[model samples]
Target chain A: MQRAKVVGTLWLSSAIEDIRGFKILILKDLSSSKGGYFLAVDTVQAGVGDEVFTVSGSAARQSEATKNSVSDTAIVAIIDRVNEENI
Target chain B: MQRAKVVGTLWLSSAIEDIRGFKILILKDLSSSKGGYFLAVDTVQAGVGDEVFTVSGSAARQSEATKNSVSDTAIVAIIDRVNEENI
Candidate 1:
């Protein structure tokens, strides 16, 4: 899972038949050495500016809301706090 | 699919039980806005310095060699030439 911040929503005029019921979110990847953004399916009801953890790959399709769709990325959890532990 | 350049190989003394038979290659993303590196299962016998295209998510598992394992990225094709047809 990678940490990200939900930055905006995506409006698709047309989409795959199975994913029409879900909302697509634009997320900025926070941990990359260089800043970058990508799209993911919102499964935790995350909104703009929320900190969330996203699961990628086939595991993304395990969500009840996205199980039948071809979703490859989905917000699986919302982060509360990050504990600082020295490695 | 995304284009990448194979930079090196990864040797894991420990690995997922089902994916032990494959070779892992480290690739530099050639198309990301910001340069980034990632690991992928090599299914096409790719070697260092090879230009290749990778498939992510469940599509990575479609390869017969990776079908039984949990691979999220796999090198599916090697780049031959870039056609300059204007989009």
Candidate 2:
């Protein structure tokens, strides 16, 4: 799992059958200090400015929205707050 | 696979054995044009600000650097250019 910040949303008018009816979002990768981002399918109702926890691979499939769904990445949790004092 | 732009690099002092000695980067997810990003292991010699093709899951493990290495996401190709006239 990794910590990420939601940057934007993805609207797919026509998508692969397996990915139909899913809300996709663009997330900024925060696991590393370097600023980066990626497209992820959001299971949780994350908004444009929310911080989230992302799970990839088989673990991503275990999410409530991806259960039995063909997805490689999913937002597993919505972070309430971040305490990065150690860093 | 997804089309992404390399945004930055990640340095890990302490990492899981499976991911040791690998160059990790933060990638902006451009496949959906949502301006999102994710932390990914770079298999190709992709520099920051380069557009890349990313492969996730078991497929990522098939890359030259990841062959027999335990990783879930890897930069599979360095995109020469993007023609998004369709978008």
- Candidate with top lDDT is 1
Predicted structure 1, TM vs. truth: 0.53
Q: How many clashing residue pairs appear in each of the predictions shown? A: 0, 6
Off-target runs (Cα >4 Å) in candidate 2 are A85-87, B4-55, B58-87
B6-73 per-residue lDDT for model 2 (tens digits): 88988887777888899999998876535777988876678899877665886466544676677777
Ten residues in a row with the worst lDDT in model 2 chain B? B78-87
TM-score of each: 0.53, 0.52
CA lDDT of every candidate = 0.73, 0.70
| Model 1 iRMSD vs. native | 11.0
lDDT (C-alpha) at residue A33 in model 2: 68
**Could you tell me which 10 consecutive residues in candidate 2 chain A have the lowest summed lDDT?**
A10-19
The residue-by-residue lDDT of candidate 1 on A21-74, one tens digit each, is: 666666777767565666677888898889899988777888787776546678
Per-candidate DockQ vs. reference: 0.06, 0.07
